[model samples]
Target: MRRIWFALFGGLFGAVGVAFLGAFRADALADPTSLATFSLWLGASTLYVLGGLDASIGDFDWYQLVGLGNVCLGLQMVARAAMTLADGTGETEPLLATFGGVVGGLTLAYIGLDWFRGGRHFDLSTFEESPTADPE
Candidate 1:
């Protein structure tokens, strides 16, 4: 069941990433802002797809993929906040968003690193356990 979910999500993210990259290519010279937005989306989608693949195949540490995803999301949010602020709307929302993104991204990355280093902050045995645990 989890593998199915991962496969579905991976396909979705792959499709979205391809679309975003196509759009970026089409309007490559349009504007710097669009470039930033599209690039961020592309990065996030790619990371998500990779994470999904890892989840499905058990080829890598789940926390690492999750951390990467969180970092990408944070970057996207920061970019959004920057674009909003650049519009000269004088809104505090952008500031808050940026702060939130930075804090969230950093925190997640830290947690991921700890987990990767065997910190064992929480038992993730459910995810680690697999029917293929024994080679027979």
Candidate 2:
């Protein structure tokens, strides 16, 4: 059941993330508004995935994935802000945006594949215990 939820989340948000990243990378729009819009979409996708994972896992340790996604989103936002402020006045490396895009893209691909494949296989264990007599 948990795995199913995870798959659903991955399939949905993963597609959105991939789309936003691809657009940001390939589009020729250089304006701050365009970049901001892309960043917002990426951030939204990140949050959605994180929330879904947390709900499905039900463990604090499972939040690491969410943290990583948030970090990537942060990087994307920071890069966009810096780029907008610079406004071509000074040379600046778009490292944050590029790295975030790469990470998001790779993660989306991995998550989508895993979701489609029905998730990783794990051995299930069953236990039996002696039954007590029923009272009349």
Candidate 3:
């Protein structure tokens, strides 16, 4: 069920990205850095859904991991936005969007770390047995 939602969200993001790219001119899209960053985010989002499902067992408590992925994607988007601003080719809209992206990513990353520290309350037993546990 969660996987479905992740996949759906990723698809939606991809659609928006596609539209954004389509509306832009070819010369802008030709940027290798921009293209690579976008590609990485797309790939990461896709993997998040697929791999998350595979790793989860209805109790995987993956909010932190998912959050991390979200942050990563946001950072990429923000970087692209910053580039757009630097190039001075687009309106201020991209700059604002980039700022928003960076903020969103930072927020997500903070939440993820917080959860990892204590919010999620993951059980230590879930980890494989340590050699010391045997005490042979």
Kindly report which residue stretches of model 1 are placed more than 4 angstroms away from their true locations once superposed: 1-7, 17-29, 55-62, 91-124, 132-136
Tens-place lDDT digits, model 2, residues 37-79: 5655455455546544545444432233433444444455555
Off by over 4 Å in 3: 14-29, 55-65, 89-97, 112-136
Positional deviation of 48 in candidate 1, in angstroms?
2.6
TM-score of 3: 0.54
Instruction: For residues 67-100, write the lDDT of model 1, one tens digit per residue.
Output: 4554555565656656666777656786777667
**CA lDDT scores, all candidates in order:** 0.59, 0.49, 0.59
What's the TM-score of each model vs. the native?
0.56, 0.33, 0.54
Any residue pairs clashing in model 3, and if so which? none
lDDT of 2 at 47: 52
Residues 6-52, candidate 3: write the lDDT tens digits: 55676676777677777885754587777766775766576456434
Q: Give me the candidate number with maximum lDDT.
A: 3
Candidate 2 wrongly placed segments (more than 4 Å) = 1-13, 21-25, 28-51, 54-60, 88-136
Q: Which candidate do you rate higher for TM-score, 1 or 2?
A: 1
> Clash number for model 2?
0
State the weakest 10-residue window (summed lDDT) of model 2.
Answer: 121-130
Q: Which is superior by TM-score, 1 or 3?
A: 1
